[model samples]
Target: MENFNTDLDIAIIGGGAAGFFAAINIAEQNPNLTIAILERGKTGLQKVKISGGGRCNVTHAEFIPSELVTNYPRGEKELLGPFHTFMTGDTIAWFEERGIELKIEEDGRMFPVSNSSQTIIDCFINEAKKHHVKVLYNHSVKSISTEAYGFTLKTNQEDIFCKKLIIATGSNPKIWNLLSDLGHTIVAPVPSLFTFDIKDERIKDIPGVVAKDVEVKVLETDLESEGPLLVTHVGMSAPAILKLSAFGAVELARLDYNFKIAINFICHDGEQCMDALKTIKQDFAKKTVSNSTQFNLPKRLWKKLVIASNINETERWADLNKNQLEALVDQLTNAVFKVTGKSTFKEEFVTAGGIDLKEINFKTFESKRIPNLYFAGEVINVDAVTGGFNFQNAWTSAYIVSQSINS
Candidate 1:
């Protein structure tokens, strides 16, 4: 491997979203400051290329920083201020200024109009080049040494020195270990933003069935989430399940990924659901109970619940006994599913733990233990549920870091 010693103003130790954003903004702020991004992979932005199924969800459409911060399960308090400096609206304008327009989906996720992650990658590449930010790919960091006034980073390709350094390495264990050795606390990482693996006859063959509104609660715990729930081939997914997965990551990990979850398909309690069903039976007495769907639920899903409630396809609403009606309400309002395991959600994988939030100053995204050392993105102990919130954290923290370094 080629080896060299060089001194620079700043060195960023990742080439992902936060690294590129910080490098470009910092370089643009101070043209005289030399900057380099050291990436371990042969190509950088691999996550960005695959995020949001290759469309590259840049950020969410939530304009208010205070409201946007709520999406983050870990960094909600710490991110409020940083988001005030830079958030979704700023992100949209940033890309638009670079000649790339973003369009917001119905779910509030913003993506480039080109509908390709390549658009995002190209923008980062051009911005880095335009600002003279050197990107060194395949430069795996081996160690970090601190000097009286600066830091010396030893990588596979070369050893470099810099007055200021930024670690945006996402959830890499090696980098977290390095930070730990440098007197920083590294929070134990756990998988976040995943799907629950479930095996239940009610959802067996209805892979694509979706409940427009639901409330999923983890049995024996206070963990719960409300949103749209999707029945997947492996188990349950979508915002409702994903939100619980993210918020309860630490707790569920302790459970060994085996637990029970209660799902309220119609956002109603058991008593309320039963009353609604009674009213439905009275109104549709002549109709087949299995053929009638209440609460605006999909027909396929209604049939599953009906069968699971011991009501046959030919059972008329008028024949429904009190026991049968109660069973149907129970299935609709308090359906319980056994979560056997967990599965990562495509390339949107995120970790709930990282450099402990206490180690860094939220004002500047700088490490409190080490001056001029900053962090951004998943490298910090901040992660959000599925959606564009995770990317927003990266942008907000990175922008603040750039501003701090520029000052």
Candidate 2:
């Protein structure tokens, strides 16, 4: 730090998605911005290697900024302007221009047509190399000090000075601590995307059963979500649970990940369901209750719900009594599952908190608290539900940082 040789003109901390993206874009646009990505690991872009089951979900198919911003539980308001600047469409085009083709899944998630995460990693690496963005690996940042010129970063390898600094380290507490020491506020991190852990007779042994459309509500809370729900070995997953998990990250964490969720298996009102059941009883009087799966629900899950409603497997629809009908209606409309805990996907774990959004100037993604201090990616308090949304945030924020740098 004494020499203050200014090792880089633009120094990016973290070699993950946002870090590499910002560095490459800035270097390519400016052509003379001496940029380097100080990655703490021996290798970079490891998350890119394993995301989307190794296929690398690049960005979601959402084309509108307003709709796209809805996916993020935090930073929804702040990112609206940034997404307008650079978002899903721009992300798709950016990769397309680099000769990578992306395909959209039925669920709106976009991935490399090559079906390999390596494709994305290669593109970023090649782009960085072509733009002369030096990627310094194994340079774990220990501390950061703001200097008159720019900033001083003390890493495991060396202390480097830069004219401008961009922090894109995603959900790294140590970096957050460093930022805090530099007078930035950090929102306490909480698990975002996760699955509820439930052990119930209704859902047990019904793993792999998927209800096409269902409504899930956290009991006693305003938290609710609607989408396809999948019954896993432990409990429930898919977009329905993931959305609730993201939106209720803070509330659920405050609940200690222990709460109860009411699931509407049929996505129908209790009265309508009861009336439908009456019609179904008359229409399928001879049919076994458990065998005749209703509401397009998977057979296994239907049977479990039927049995949980006190309807035996051998009972026919005609034999169902008034109490049995009411019970069945309740089970279908408001089945409650006690969520004892949560399970996070190790490779795709997302945090709901980071640098407070108010502290950042979204117009330029620069720090209002500190001059020339930029922020991007999950390093900020913005996080989204599963899909390709988290990656889109990385791309959008990184792109904005690059644009801000050159402008």
Candidate 3:
């Protein structure tokens, strides 16, 4: 750990979304104050470069703060105040003011109109340059110490002294480890935004078949999500599954990623399915069971349903008695599949746990226990479901921390 002091007003660790945003806000507010961003990696904004498959989902278009914060599974309650201060609409406006136009997808995820993550990346870099914020890449901080008037950041390259310190390292174990050394509790880290691995023959071949609407219910938990479901080569995926995976990240890990998932392909209840099945059976009584399905499921899936239901493909619908109809209804409403493992959905992946939210004040993102020490972004125990919620957290936390920093 080299110790070389460079006096500054604020020393921000991590140069990802949160760190850069904080730097921009602080520099814009206090132009005379010196600010530097220390990044461990060679390049900053690695996540931003890869998010939304390089298009960079900046934020969701949802303007309602309460509704927006609800997507966060961990820090929803704490984010209420910060979001009220700087919400998604503000994020769009902020970028727009910087000459970056954002387009909202049909799903409500907002991204740069250029349709490339480089646009967003360049915007941040240009903004940082315009604000005179110095970003030092590959300068990893080894430790941070707080003095009466300021903080000292010991890094691999050099030691820096700053009046205010902000940790925006995103969701890395090493970052939380540093925080723990600084006297802060950390919530155990777990994987979020993953795809379930189902060892089922039904969806093995139809890996790309996506249902526009689906309802996923964990067999033993109250966890569920209603949205699009995708068939993967290994099992199932999609927005609905990804959301459920986020909410049950810890629980699923506890179970060793082994659980039974009930997938309602049609997004209907048992009674609705039963009623629909009865009508279909009556209309197609003379047709082969394999030819007529209870719902408008894909033809490719009908074969698998017949085999899984233990009904003969050649059997006529008339041969299907009340028990068979009930069985078919059950299958339609609650198609059970064994989830054996998990797969990474890198486009929207994020960690579930981080610095305990209680240790940091939501109003300013400053540590209550350590004065002048603050945190922002995924580095804290805050995570949200897919669709740009994570990026919103980064922006909101950075804005709060920037406003709190003294000039």
Candidate 2 structure quality by residue, lDDT tens digits, 155-209? 8878899989999889999999999988889999999999989999888877898
Once model 3 is optimally superposed onto the true structure by TM-score, how far is the C-alpha of residue 407 displaced, in angstroms?
7.6
Whole-model lDDT values for every prediction:
0.91, 0.91, 0.85
Would you give me the overall lDDT of model 3?
A: 0.85
Write candidate 3's Cα lDDT for 219-300 as tens digits: 9988888898888888888888988889998998898899999888887888887787777778887898887654567776
What order do candidates take by lDDT, descending?
1, 2, 3
Tell me each candidate's TM-score. Answer: 0.97, 0.98, 0.94
Tens digits of per-residue lDDT for model 1, 242-271: 999898989999999999999889988888
The RMSD of every model to the true structure, in order and in angstroms, is: 1.4, 2.0, 2.2
